[model samples]
Target: MTGEEFQNRLNAAFVFEGANYGRVHLIHGTQDAYSQEVLQFSGHLALSDAFKAVFLEAVELMNTYCRPRVKAPLSEHYPQFLARLANAFHTLCGAECAAIRGYPRPAFTTLRNVFDDVVLVSASLQKVTDFYKIEGIDPNGKFDPAAAKKARKDEEFKVRKLMTGSDSGLSADVTSELSKLNDLFDFEVHGGRLSLTDAMAFMKGTGPLHVLPKFVPQTFAVFMNRFTEVGWAVHRLVPAIQPPGVSMPKEWADRWTLVDESFEIAVRSLSNELGMKVGDAYAEFIKVKFPFNAGAVFPL
Candidate 1:
């Protein structure tokens, strides 16, 4: 769909939310706000209507197929639920789209990597919780049941400390870096959830590739490489904004670096193998337009 037509559709979709009309109108007026440049620079090539349809369908299928396999309650298994959805999205899309034949392997690999990361992180957190349960040591080095109850409130803190030694004064820097790396694979933060119409607008920005019947591995590779770079950049920059004295465990730090290095190598190899030019195009576009939307575009 043409940009203008897509914008109208989006505006219409937001009509039910009376408060969103003015913002929607402004978004409609600013072509650049919903332009191809935004999509390319943001490494958001997967934001197409076709992708969304396939993704939602896959999510439904996963809910039907994988939900039963999960032993935990739905709330507790949210991350697994999402991992399954992502897996289903990749599997169904790959099967339905002929173009995926060329890119299927890498694309499938990427999805698997993301799924594994989620599972790994979740498992790590669970292990830490189990360790605390068995050892009965809280962050303050105390063993009070009341404190333990309160500690559960900030579950992420416990997990973060265990994974990165946030309390030990060793793994702070490394933890920060790993956090940045994690963002690269996180879609909710990077791709901000959208209403169906807005999602369509974002997808339209991907141009003709979205409508294709097959996967474009090269395009996916280009987008992922940029996304990964942005994550690293955020990690490097955060220390400047907030002086770092946090500590991480040596083993965890080394393993984190190894993972980061592997991703870096994979990104470079994929770029060369796919002959992706999206990164260059994105760089050029950002050089010219970043100044105008500096606040909206860049955040560490």
Candidate 2:
């Protein structure tokens, strides 16, 4: 087929999906569909926006304070950690974009990447000695292939081992739960049978299968809540990883405080609206997510 023929055929397919299967095509109906979805769940939409703001603020704090001006011997590895943290924020931005555009399956898949990023960060922080070990450099600036291979292997952060090993400093119970969570993320990322079925726009009995994106309010709510929880856990670890002799600025600290307080309020309100019976809902969420350091707060 010619290029124009292929394009016309694809557009016809999209139009058919919208008319028959209730699918929102990317180029045509997604914006109107998303606008209606947001209106239908304004409270959850606001909470998603709040989570994005918090994640953005956390990235700004890292760019301003955690990123180094001059590379020092003691801070040589700061860039490695900061890069992963920044990447987590960027990936989350992508997830939010996908979600708001009515592509929740990919949004959920993007979140798995963010989860691994945070896990890697947590393991690095816990096993600081392994992370800070410096390698010998050649004075002649010659690279040794054997030494480089060894260095790469040594720097590997195996998620399963790190989360479950004794060196990770996590309790056995927490590690067990994390292992299950890891498996769940893997299933989502790998497109398991259940994941595929859930992505289809089905109702109580029977319906046409939708190939294009459609808004799933319950899935959106669940993913948004998980995103906020992960953001909260990662942000709380930032102060502990600040450069030696450097503290978080008072203005940024205060901003974090304001955001944290507001987030707690929003989380509690949302949880109650969603019929959660847990009292002190935000604190409970923190405890469940990061039981190893449930009491920790951001900005030190």
Candidate 3:
């Protein structure tokens, strides 16, 4: 859609109870306000409709907190990776849509793909020292071949360094946030859940031979959690206006713990039942795995 159209859909619309010094929009998620405000949008809304309210609020918050705050373009920092980032966001929107439609398999699968988007953002930050080396980007952005190559083939060790805060001048909070996401992203991308076939079979109930719920709302929540987590990395990487004041939303593991429980049962049981070789599973979804630690990747 055109920039004007996007603006029309997303511009400063009051949502989930007007944000206030006295109002309570941030916490409790304002179930009543969610409908009264967000559902006010009619017609075929942008795919980002669900999170637009919070995202715009985040922009304002970042501007308020970012130091050396500049209204310069985001592309200034990510000139070499703009197109890929857009593609990732677009596909992530699709995943969000799938999640809404109750397709857990695609929701989780596509979430894994977008994790690469997170790596792309992190890697570009590593490659560029200046915040505004590249010029602005339009809605239709150009491809950077180098970025495309590195995003696909960059070593896990290097990516982990940036993500885990072993490199890059990132805050402990952001790196800590990223480490949690990256390890989980690795889990999905590398078949820690189940293969697409297995997923389809499990859904159909023809293979697993057990009745399971067709969909889980938490599946969508899991995808959204990653979206915001990566978005957190991107927001910090951009030139500062200020640091965030509102709490970063971080509730994926609660839902995912349940999903993983089912995953462990179905995947492990099926692997044993079918006599499936570990080699086959690894070969299907292999990506290099990086070592993560208690302090860096997970914390008690």
TM-scores, all models, native as reference? 0.29, 0.63, 0.38
- 294: Cα error in model 2, Å: 14
- Which residue segments of model 2 deviate by more than 4 Å? 1-26, 39-74, 128-176, 199-205, 261-300
Better of 1 and 3 by lDDT: 3
* Candidate No. with top TM-score: 2
Off by over 4 Å in 3: 1-79, 122-156, 168-180, 192-213, 231-300
Could you tell me which residue pairs clash in candidate 2?
Answer: none
Error of 3 at 62 (Å): 19
Residues 188-282, candidate 3: write the lDDT tens digits: 66774633444676578766632222333345445544444333333222222122232222332232233323323333332466564422232
> What residue runs in model 1 are displaced by over 4 Å at the alpha carbon?
1-27, 31-34, 39-44, 47-58, 63-121, 124-126, 130-149, 165-176, 179-300
Q: lDDT per prediction?
A: 0.37, 0.57, 0.41
Q: How well does model 1 score by local distance difference test?
A: 0.37
TM-score winner between candidates 2 and 3: 2
lDDT by residue for model 1 (118-140), tens: 32333332343432332334544
